[model samples]
Target: MRPLRNIFAAILLLSGAALWATARADDGAGRTPTPHPPRAQGEHCVADTDFMRRNHMKMMMAHRQDVLHEGVRTPQFNISGCVNCHAVKGDDGKPVSFASPQHFCRSCHTYAAVKIDCFECHNSRPETDGKAAATEIDGEDAARLAAFLRETKQ
Candidate 1:
């Protein structure tokens, strides 16, 4: 009975050591890398990466109050601005959007098990894309875009 108990304890310790080693080697170092959004053509963001990671939700809340009560819609700290700039292409080359886990927002959000409701009404991608949206905007089209922003700001 004493021999059997010693063998069981040894096995348990070995198992734990193996598991710890594998966890540490995930990226060949003791530390795991943080998740980063896909690269954008522009090398800048509304804030530095560390600052944004810590304060993004707090910033969004203030942005919400400003947009709703004041109707102030500057580009900074806006969800639309982030989505447009951080948009990552999927395997099909179409933008990976909020609907998919591959989307920039959804990646870390889902990983952290936080549920987000921002995309319930908003389109995941921006209004403009290649050639079509890039082409010269007519007066009517520009007005429509403004109207769309106003309507969605609500």
Candidate 2:
């Protein structure tokens, strides 16, 4: 009986050691690298990479408040600049919209499990020939929207 108990204890210790080694091996073996989203197309960002990563939201919000409430617009901290510079190309060889996960903003936001509402009122894709597509509203769609608004008013 004593010999049997000793053997059982040795087997348990060896199994645990084997399991720990397997886990340690897995920690560095064939692990997928962390996702590194593309950065600005320009030579430099508006701010340093570390600073931008930490405080970009604050900067953009302050800029938004200034632009909307004070009528002050500057190139620094402009959201449009960020969108244009960080635009990622899709399979069609055109810039992807916010709907695509490959879009510059979506890559990090999806990884962080963060919801992005900025694109709700802002264009996710860069303009072509320096013209914005947001300025246009189809006549038929406009009429439908107007009708819907009038019905809801009643």
Candidate 3:
């Protein structure tokens, strides 16, 4: 009876191993793996010119101190605002994007001696989708946004 029990235990162990191997094989064979898609043209959902005009100052203010630091802390804000504009389709055929204070904000900020550490957390290129571009903003809309930024500064 003891010998029979040992045989049963061995059989159970073998069955488990076999099942695991079969599952792995099945997983591999279940579907044809998709190839990575190509990089999309343009800067994703960002409004190239308007985005540059608006929010540049606010972003600069947020990163000014960090830019001066040799070892800066990770920024408190994520790229959501910038991503709202810069979001683009990714190489994997999914939405991907980034927003760097340096890329969008540095030109103006540097003129004012505001050092920006844009590379710390933000990538030079952000991914985005067309959702951000669907909004119909006129010149007045851009001007208003710019005015709001100016108000924030004061």
lDDT of each: 0.69, 0.75, 0.47
Task: Name the regions of candidate 2 deviating beyond 4 angstroms.
Answer: 1-33, 133-154
Pairs with backbone N, CA or C atoms under 3 Å apart (clashes), candidate 2: none
Local accuracy of candidate 1 as per-residue lDDT tens digits, 67-108: 999999878887777777778887878665555556787668
Superposition error at 20 for model 2 (Å): 7.4
Clashing pairs in 1: none
Model 3 per-residue lDDT tens digits across residues 28-130: 6544342322333445533344573566556556665565564464533344455333344444653332121223343344345444454335443443343
Model 3 ranges off by over 4 Å: 1-77, 83-102, 128-154
How well is each residue in 20-76 modelled by candidate 2, as lDDT tens digits? 889978786544444578867898999899998888888988998999999998998
lDDT of 3: 0.47
lDDT of 3 at 117: 51
lDDT of 3 at 48: 45
lDDT assessment of candidate 1: 0.69
Prediction-by-prediction clash tally = 0, 0, 11
